[model samples]
Target: MEILRVKEILNEKGWRNKDLADKIGTSENSVSAIVTGKKFPKPETLVKIADVLDIDIRELFNPSKSVDLQEIFTKDENGNLKSVGFIKK
Candidate 1:
């Protein structure tokens, strides 16, 4: 489960979803899902988003929510697959 205040951060920074989408080379709909907590981005995408937003990647995570680390990745931050409504595919 995700708990990042992505939308809030975007608002605080005055960034539209289109801005994020453009920065990441993805569609606005994909960015919207992540912003709304309807989906999680791929790790690489997450890194890109964090960079674009000028935030730590950890800032996008919900520290209070505990998702199994094993279920999240196969190798490392840049590796294999684990998805839930990940729209950028």
Candidate 2:
């Protein structure tokens, strides 16, 4: 999720961060965090976000990519997985 995308969506809907915060019962800072990906909202928050944006949750998390199992379960020397390859059986 890109901040630019969210900004575009908001602009298209003629909504401001403060307006969305009021509608969702959250603070402008929280909304900003979500838009910037500094924080991921919970399920309920996501619901509110979707409602405010008039978009489906599925749209928020578009699933068009192929599954990559290795990305789901692998780690490097630093204990941080590169998460790039498909699953190796």
Q: Evaluated with lDDT, which candidate comes out highest?
A: 1
True-structure RMSD, every candidate: 13.0, 12.9
Residue 80 error, candidate 1, Å: 50
Please, what are the lDDT tens digits per residue for candidate 2 over residues 1-89?
A: 35235656778788898998999999999989877778878989888788878898666664466564544547788998666556644
Q: How far is candidate 1 from the true structure (C-alpha RMSD, Å)?
A: 13.0
How many clashing pairs per prediction, in order? 0, 0
Which ranges in model 2 have alpha carbons more than 4 Å from their true place? 1-5, 62-89
lDDT of 1: 0.81
The 10 consecutive residues of candidate 2 with the worst lDDT sum are: 62-71
lDDT of 1 by residue, 36-78 (tens): 8888888899889899889988887667844444222334477
How well does candidate 2 score on lDDT at residue 78? 92
Best by TM-score: 1
